[model samples]
Target: MTSLLFVDDETKLLRILSSYFTKKGFVVHTASTGEEARSKLRDADARIIFLDLRLSDATGIELLQEFVPRYPNKLFVIMTAYSDVESAVTAMKAGAFDYVSKPAKMDELEIIIRRACEWLDMKQENRTLKEKISKMMQDQEMIGVSPAMKRVFRMVERAAETDATVLLEGESGTGKSRIARMIHRWSDRKNQPFVSVNCAALPEQLLESELFGYEKGAFTGAHAKRKGKFEAARNGTIFLDEIGEISLPLQAKLLQVVQEKSFMPLGSNQTVHVDVRIIAATNRDLKTMVEEGLFREDLYYRLNIIDIFIPPLRERKEDIPPLIEQFLDKQRAKYNKPFTLPPELIDRLVEYPWPGNVRELENAVERAVVLCRDEQLSIEDFPREIRHAKPDRPPSDIALDPTKSLPEQLESIEKKLILDALEQTGGQIAAAARLLSISRQRLMYKMNKYSIR
Candidate 1:
């Protein structure tokens, strides 16, 4: 049953109203002073408070103002004298549900309470709907049963335990960005902002400004001071997607942020410090870029503290069925056309090498959902490319390391030694650096270089 509270100095009215409401199946509470009423409001689960306009301690309007903003789910009805119409209007503006003049009929009071309950219920329902929509908008998740994904899951769990920089390396559209989100969601900073910037998507000029916020009037069109992703992700994680595509100058700024935990925004003189965890993802080989002098060595070392190499979807064929089912169900729900793929269609889909990876598979499923005439999707319903696609080669057929040169092999060995030393000493950088015969800063740079997280 819903609870109701009557806050009035009038002992006679409070007694009568309390008895009437209790008999009508409401759990009634009464308080004389404003202070007593406030205590009751906090302690009790009253949905509607029938508040007197004038109390011994304070006016009902004042109490209404204090509580309306704090407890929006609860309704406050002003019980005012006929001459206090102006005060009643003020109470309404301050978020009171309604006003009932003194000596009001029981029928009118009941109707007002009923209406307020309905409105509160509607607001709660609307909030629930919005939450569902938000989850749908950020619906991407990993779906795989392969050993490769099992390893990725273990890596995710390990990375979640600490606030280390993580680098997700994979082919384009292989769900590296989604895995970044998974890492953030599982980390200690999950409650804080998870800001992401795609280095390849923005121009060099704008990308620098977007990472570190600028002061007001720092640049043309800079009308107001705006906080960047770094500031916004305070005590949280900031994901840099397609990080390898970032310009060399911007990489220098990023290296400073990683090394010193500070950076000056574009067009700003003052340096802003931030304590944020970084998670960067890229398809490009940072080692190759570093060797070619296209990428900064220091920045590469800083970003590559903890590396998670995600195998492309084509390399994990065993995961295809579950991935297809998940995508099909999602697209069916989205398009309002629930359907199932035929056995032959499923076989063909699993055989077709997903060159675009998970992204391409999702598109294929959506396309099938939109064009299928019946509940059972056939080969003809799929895209032309998918229908005629060749089978993918086994993972064993491909190169395990993929780096074919002596320097690249040594680079791989050096990364392993650094990671092994860090692990043996439980992430004590100075000790790990000593074991690797490198300075502390050098080891730090090396860990960042290889992204040992």
Candidate 2:
């Protein structure tokens, strides 16, 4: 049975309420003074408290302020005379769940209790949902200890502290979109909506309408008015992924929004203003595109205000072990099984160049965990691409000596690889640079350092 405490200075009224509620199948408790009510509250287990607005020793608001913060799970309903309705409203504002006028009707009190119980149940469900979301985010948090990732983390922290436009530039599968969300989650607008739109996912017309809402009859199939991402993300964030794919015309429109914080909807003269933080991501080099006259120089400059470049997994191989562990932990929790990896497996994975970056590594780990019935993950359990993958340079090509220090051995391998690339390209610097996947300037620097003729 639900428990309730009725606090009133009138002994007769308290007795009447207590008897009525007890007969109605409630576990009822009563107190005739403010001091006695406080004592009863501390000892009695009650979900609802009926507090008289004007107690003999203390006002209901005073006791309410003391109790609500202390016992946030409990409900307090104010009992006041009809003439004291104004004070009862003040009590409600002060944290009383509801108010009941003196000469309280049995039906009315029952209705209030029903509503309060429903509210408490809804609150509990919301709390549980929030807990689940928090756990998921904690499990999928960014895992990196490499210097490259540390620099990214510091930039993310600084970006989260402000509402600047952030442009995340990195190769595909490097978690640029995830970093965008991290910025939003840690920003001041964390409680607000975080809207994401893939500019490449839709065509120009559709993408424009999706971004800025259309009025009725504005477009061919415009049956009714629709709110766009900007309106939906009011006072929050909008992540535009694959931003470089946007058409030049749409780029101009987007540039206006970025510059003025306002945009006109498709076929609509009226402009809709929005207060939103824009975070854009792309795998392409916007600066190169700007110089090539493909992308607008102005828009590129605007979005590059807080540019963050996320390095690919191959460049940060030291972070691979921790990333693998994080992915394994998530899979283990999901499958409710222990999965072990051979130490040699880790070494091979670290040596392999992850072309698809973190996403590929995570997918490989998940696949291994799901297929390994013996609880020991092996390279064979992973995709063929990962298992058969070879290091960038073969040890046979370097003829590495075991006596040399690790650094010297690595330098020998690098120099040998450069020499081979130069020979294959007929000593053409540009072609060799392309074959090595290094800039011409970088390859030239290495040639000078190694004194290659």
Candidate 3:
């Protein structure tokens, strides 16, 4: 139910307005003075507020200015006598949702209240949608078709079907967070909130208060009770990214919530129970941390109920092609350009060792797209590091005679090119094959026959 607060100095006006709104099925709360109104606001989660301009002790515009910034989400409407048009205009500029004249028509007031309520609803919906979109964009899909990736996909599919806590383990930039979101998206709780918290982003005190809300007067400057992410994500999934970064004490608290499904807010005696699933991802080795006494073994066991490990880009060269295509499409749409990556350029991309993994590949693609002028992208569009790549010239290139047989000469050139690609790519066979404009299998066969390392 939506809460409404009305503040007016006139006793009769306050009673009449409050009674009328009460009959309209709103939980109406009234105050006869600005002081009383501010006090009531502290206790009430009012979504819309109505303040009279001609207050006995304070100007309505002053109160509006004071409250708007503090509670920007709450919709405020100012009321004044018809002659007080100037004050009403001032209130509107100060963030009043609307202004009403004294002795206002009941029909007009009802219409204004209805519209204010709608605005509040739409704003809340937009906020929720934006959060979801931000999470989705950050959670790039797991891109790989290799056996390793296939195994990870199978684990993800199984994990998505259950409510068990999932612990994603992998090196930095290996898309652990992406795997977490995919699990949430495929779960039955997909329609609910997917709240993510970066355990390493905040200090321990702030992080504690964030995970478990604080009551009003709970601490200095905590003037009002705030809902924590766990409560906000009721019946949803709460992804604790960088969970390993949290201190041991906080980890115990988190484990309690995971096991008991309840937590107490800071400075509050009562416990708040919630139905939230926890998905944690980390680049650090938790087992080592556990052995080193940095992480709790019990919590580690609980979170590792279902483990999904994301392989790094260097280990899965087979996935680079698809990832490049996906990133190119995304970049083209973002930049509003119709660009196609040349096959040769993609081949060069496949040969590069992406130290930063898929994220580096994405940034490289975006950079190339921005630099590209023609519809077809070339090697020149790539960064200087990639464009200037060249293999070491073999001694045969200088020593070969021009009088050799055509087939033998061609074989010599092929061997030299293959060797050069292999050297440039740090002996990565798949990358070398891509540079040679041939399938990995064919390159492997040729390498075996030619006795190439």
* lDDT, model 3: 0.83
Q: What is the C-alpha lDDT of each candidate?
A: 0.83, 0.87, 0.83
Candidate 3: list runs displaced more than 4 Å. 1-140, 384-453
Highest-TM-score candidate: 2
Specify the highest-lDDT model's number: 2
Residue-wise C-alpha lDDT for candidate 2, range 1-453, written one tens digit per residue: 789999888989878878888898999999878899889889999889999988778999999999999999899999888788678767867888777778899877887787677768867765654563454359475766677876787688789999999999999999898899888987899999999999999989999999998999997899999999999999999999999999999999999999999998877899889999999999998989999988999999999999999999999999899889888888888888888799999998999898899999999899888777688899899889888888666455446588999999888889999999999876866457768976555788999999997
Q: What TM-score would every model get versus the actual structure?
A: 0.56, 0.58, 0.56
Q: Give the range where candidate 2 is weakest over 10 consecutive residues by summed lDDT.
A: 128-137
Tens digits of lDDT, candidate 3, 1-453:
778998998889878888888898889899888899899899998888999997888889989989999998998988888688777777877988877777877777887788777778978866654554445446656566666876787687789899999999888788877887788897999999989998899999899999999999988989999989899889989999899899988988998898999999999999999998889999899999999999999999999999888888878888898788778778777877777877877777777777788878888888888787877788877778777766333354345567898788778888888899999876766457657866555788988878987
Model 1 C-alpha lDDT per residue in residues 1-453, reported as the tens digit of each score: 889999999999999999998999999999999999989988999999999999999989889888888887898899988898788777867877677778888987887777777768878865654453344235656765676876787687789898888889999989988888888887788898899898899998888888898888988999998889899888999999999998888888889988888988767888889999999999999999999998999888788888999998878988888888888778767767768877877777778888899999888888887787888888887888877777765565223466458778778777877888989866766446657765555777887888777
Error at 360, model 1, angstroms = 0.4
Return whichever of 2 and 3 wins on TM-score: 2
Worst 10 residues of 3 by lDDT: 391-400
In model 2, pairs of residues that clash are: none
